[model samples]
Target: MDALIATVKDNDLVVAFALVGLVMGVAILISKFLTRGKFQASAIAIILGLVLAYVGGVATGGEDGLADISLFSGIGLMGGGMLINLAIVATGFGASFDEMKKSGLGGIIALVLGVVLSFVIGAVIAWFFGYRDPIDLTTIGAGTATYIVGPVTGAALGAGSGVIALSVGAGLVKSVLTMVVTPFVAKYIGLNNPRSAIVFGGLLGTTSGVTAGLAATDKRLVPYGAMTSTFYTGLGLLMAPSVLFFAVKALVG
Candidate 1:
């Protein structure tokens, strides 16, 4: 047993990959058998991950969640910003300029509208919650664009940890909602083509949610949606900390 434990610990990253794969596999099965594919596997896996993280935190009283248990320590690195950014870049690699041209002006409009709407919504929510500071408002607003943007904006603007956490929560809620709701409304919203998928993804601007939602709606649309969503993330990262931050500060001041 000691030898096996040491072996597992030595190859913790491989174990973490296996663990994530297992969770995804199970989530896929649940999505197929239980939900009949109404809910996406990625969405289910996210919910399961959150539950496990909460449990791990409560049991260990540690900040790193499941990673604090040692056996799953590699999850910390595997889920870190480096790997996340790499995945985003990898997703972008699959995009084709020809396909992107099909989206054109509609895609650009969606991207701009998505960012502005999410920022306004997040800022309003932050204000309603008694956070009057520009940094807090901007951080949370950027989070509504995506969880990644939230932390990046907060760090760049020197926002508090609590505000960052709130921003992450707000983004998570938007992601989950996007994932859960897209399929139901896809047909009604005319989300039936590559151009529409691109626009939809740009509007939502949550890569995981947009990808998973589009997957549920139509697997063929995933690449198109993911492509624009990737650009949306990049644009958000560029605008949130600088342009949006300054705008909020000016308004608040």
Candidate 2:
């Protein structure tokens, strides 16, 4: 037992992989049992992962959550932008390029609409919450677009840390909602092909949410939806702290 423990410790990355797989398997089983296939396994796993991260943070008093534990150091790398982006690219290669050609302008429209709508919604919420600063409103609004964009916009705009955290939380809620709701709405929204997938991805813009939701809807659509969804982040990063902030400022101030 000691030898095996030492071996796992020596190869912490392998342990991280194993732990993630194990947690995912458990999450899948729980999803299947609880929802009877109504809810998505990946969505359940994401929620479970978040809960565990919270618990880990409370237990360790560390800001990085689960990654703060020495044994889970590998999670930081596994979940980093590099690996996540690599996965997105890999999945994108599985997409049909011909269908992508079909989506061209519509996909661009969706991206624009998605970022605008999400940012507006977030900014509105911030306003209702009594946050009057342009920086705070923009940061939180950008967060509604996506968590990554939230912090980036906040840092660029010099927003305080508390506002940035709120922005991240807003993005997380949107991601979870997208993941949980997509499959139920897939048919009604005409999310049946690559073109719709691209539009859907653009509208939601959270890569994990759009990808996982599309995966549950149709595995083939994951790449299509995620392709536009991936661009959503970059576009959001560009728009949030600049044009969106100025617009919100003009409206409120």
Candidate 3:
């Protein structure tokens, strides 16, 4: 009982858990109102809930306090949250890809290839400039690739687990890069319609989700992505460091 109290007090797990529950409830309410029983929002709500949990958990120092937790266990929780969120969003918006048919697959493939190529190119440049840490270079490369190619490509390169620090660092870098490049790519691709914008936002969110899942030592990306707004770039920036801090702490502890 004393240990339980200490855990609660040190980590603020209660508050974090409560916040997550609240966010999930809100998501359900929103989905019900918007979809009117035709579409389920549970996946989206779950995602959002996890995001809230992570943000709240970090704010309360759960990562530092939960030092006893295994890296894989934490990552599992995080990744589960992210997958739930993705499933929800994908169910709602992935239909757009079907509409585009040939173009959709082509676009996804192109984006992936672009990201990989860009990372290779960026790594060479970083090396030429005398960057020593391969992990750091990889992070920089992944971020640059994501900006030039898209989220899929960026995530593929960024998800390397070579070093926990570099992987987390890459996540932050990718978020910044996504913010800078998403708008441009959307505009260039003629994604000006409101529907297109919504889908694009979901795609970007998914990219973040996948990267966080693969890179996070604790696997908390699912929850983080779910709680985050699909359209808000600032939210991504705010959450990236929180995720990274927790991840690094988990590694250190």
Candidate 4:
């Protein structure tokens, strides 16, 4: 038993991947049977992962969640930025530029509106919560566009770690909300075809959430939505520090 445990620990990253696959499989099964696919498998898997992370944190009283456990330590590396970026790149490779061009002016409008609206909403929420500093507000606002944007903006602006953490949390909530709401609103929002999916992706701007949501709505639309959402993320990253931050600073500082 001791020898087996040591071997598992040594192959921690591989084990982490296996565990994630297992979770996704279970979540897919649940989506197919229990929810009839109304609740997306990705969303369910995300919820399950969060639950596991919470449980791991509670059990070990550690900040790294499941990674704090010696056996699951590889999860920290597996879920790190390198792998996440790789996944994004891989997804981008599947998208067609011609399809993106079809979205045209509508896509551009969606992207601009999405960033501005999300940032305002996030900044307002931060202000209501007593976060008066422009830097903190900008960081959290950037997070509303996407989790990746939040940290990037926060780091560039020299915001505190706590503010950066809050930004990430806000972005996660938006992602989950997007995943849960997309399917239900798909019909009303005209999210049926590729052009609309591209626009929808820009409007939401969270790659995982947009991709998973579109997957639940229509698997064919996933790539289209993901492509625009990727662009939206880049736009948010670019604007958050220079444009958005400056506007906030001018207003509050």
Candidate 5:
């Protein structure tokens, strides 16, 4: 356990980034091929990530015994896993692609608003907690916020606490919040069109793709959902680190 923790501490950034890229690549490929293009890249990435983590743990002979894999870890590995599920469900039952195309601008506006809303919500919560220190709150808030908006927010929160616990916690919190809020917000704001469904479906498909592989299921719907989720998850991952960087800057400034 100690040795594994040391290794992780020593190579945290490298390992995390490598895992992120590798997982995203693998998930995308798997969904593209195995699911006959029904799945998403993000889903394949997550499953591959879990496999890598488990393999790494085994190779290192870590005494933690898969302690690296948890709900929080899942969030890091499969950022929008749950949201993919929601997106998939919404797509399955909501608007069609034609409708989405007609409301293209509206959809874009809604997505932007959703992300902004998430950030505001996160900042408000952090402030309410009396978290006055920019450095500390930025880290915590970023971690917590990423789930809502993606890694950008999570990274922001991660600055304060370098510990995996804080990072994973923030990620998990963000994921849960996004899963619960994004869809409702989108619907309420009238972004529930076919284009939105297709977008959401793709995201869900990505998550579903990897989930299907992990669960040993070969259903097309699984991949469909996974792919849908993967798209958004990847977007989140790309944005998370940057958001964290800027978050710190805002606090300092």
Candidate 6:
């Protein structure tokens, strides 16, 4: 038993992949049987992974979550920025250039409105919480656009770690809410077709949230949604530190 455990630990990367696959398989089965696929297996897998990571952190009393354990060290790499960027690029590859073109001005409008609205809401919340600094306000506001945008803005503007963490937390909350609420609200929001999906994705710029939400609502819409959400993220990253920061400074400082 000890020797087997050691061997698995030594091959942790492969084992991590196998474990993730198994978890995803189970998530899919449960979603199919119980929710009739309304809940989305990918979202379930994400929640499950978070739970496991929390448990790992609590059990080991370490900050790195599951990756702090010897047997699960591979998870750190699997979830790192390199693999994350690769996955984002791969998702982009799934989008059809022709369909994106069909989205036209509506898609572009959605991206602008979405980023602006989300930032406004986030900035208001920061103000309510007594965040007076322009950098902190802009960083958190950008984070609401997407988690990726939050840290990038923070780093570019030299925001403190505490403010950056709050920005990330805000984005994380938005993502989880989007994932859980998408399917239930899909019909009411008229989110059935490709054009609507693109608009919705821009409004909710988190890649995982938009894609997973679309996956739950309609698997066919994922690519369309992902494309606009990707652009929204990039736009947030660009705007937050420059225009957004200056506006906040002028308004509040």
- Top candidate when judged by TM-score against the true structure: 2
**Which pairs clash inside model 6?**
none
User: Worst lDDT window (10 residues) for model 4?
Assistant: 85-94
Least accurate stretch of 10 residues (summed lDDT) in model 3?
A: 214-223
Give the per-residue lDDT of model 3 (tens digit) for 43-133: 4454453454455456566542222232223333433556546664554442344344434443344434444444555555656777655
**lDDT scores for all predictions?**
0.85, 0.86, 0.42, 0.86, 0.45, 0.85
Better of 1 and 5 by lDDT: 1
Residue 228 in candidate 2, Cα distance off native in Å:
1.0
Candidate 3 segments whose C-alpha is farther than 4 A from its true place: 1-86, 89-97, 132-164, 176-189, 193-206, 209-253
Higher-scoring candidate on TM-score, 3 or 4? 4
lDDT of candidate 4 over 1-253, digit per residue (tens): 9999988988999999999999999999999999997777876776677678778999999877788888988888987768866765676665777877878788889988999889999999999999999999999999988888999999999999999999999998998778777877899988888899988988999887887688667777887787678788889988999989999999999
lDDT of 5 by residue, 1-253 (tens): 9887667656654565655676677776777888886544544544454466466568657522233543124334333446546644554453344454564564455434433344445445666777565544444543443433333444445443343245445555444333333433443534333444434434232243223332232222233323334454455445444664466468654
lDDT tens digits by residue: candidate 1, 89-134: 5655656778779778888899988998899899988899898999
TM-score of each: 0.75, 0.85, 0.38, 0.78, 0.39, 0.82
Model 1 C-alpha lDDT versus the unseen true structure: 0.85
Off by over 4 Å in 2: 27-47, 63-65
Q: Give one digit per residue, the lDDT tens place, for model 6 in 1-253.
A: 9999988888888888988898899899988998897677876776677688778989999867788888889888887768866865675665677877988678899999999899999999999999888889999998888887898899998999999888988998898788777877998999998899989988888877887788767777888887788788888977888888889999998
Evaluate model 3: give its TM-score.
0.38
- Local lDDT at 155 for model 6: 90
Candidate 1 lDDT at 18 equals 94
Deviation (Å) of 76 in candidate 6: 4.3
